[model samples]
Target: ANQEPIHVQIRQRKGRWIGHTLRKEPSNVTQQALDWNPQGKRKRGCPKQTWKQSILDKLRTTGLTWEAAKKHANDHKKD
Candidate 1:
């Protein structure tokens, strides 16, 4: 079969969406939501990995920090 795996497709789409979000104004509601952090305590036990955390982890694996990734995303928008 010549099809991409579902996970691969999902990852590609997520990356595109994140890049689109990064290119938006900081005050944009969707962008704000991406950078938002809750200020409440969890019940207990192991803490869950947040969506932002997972995305950051993937960026780190590629040696890109949040700021760098944002810049890269914005730069690509010009092309």
Candidate 2:
């Protein structure tokens, strides 16, 4: 006997197309516990020293004031 094929739908959000079958599966207790890890414990390191120095170097080359360069770095950090 021929079996029926599963039906699936695709969804689009914010100009992104997502396949229906790619949906996240239900989480069990173990997965839930893993997801509940303390957010405060996460630590992200600063960007590479070479990259930061390059930005500073560029700012100096462009004749930007130290304060302006600092502000630029701060704004970039937000991204």
Alpha-carbon RMSD to native, per candidate: 2.0, 18.7
Give the winner by TM-score. Answer: 1
lDDT of each: 0.85, 0.37
lDDT of 1: 0.85
RMSD, candidate 1, Å: 2.0
lDDT of 2 by residue, 1-79 (tens): 5744433221113102111111223364432432343434334684334423443465576787546643443444222
Model 2 segments more than 4 A misplaced: 1-49, 72-79
Of candidate 1, the 10-residue stretch with the lowest lDDT total is: 43-52
**Which residue pairs in model 2 clash with each other?**
none
Q: Candidate 2, 56: how far from true, in Å?
A: 0.7
Per-residue lDDT, model 1, residue 27, is 95
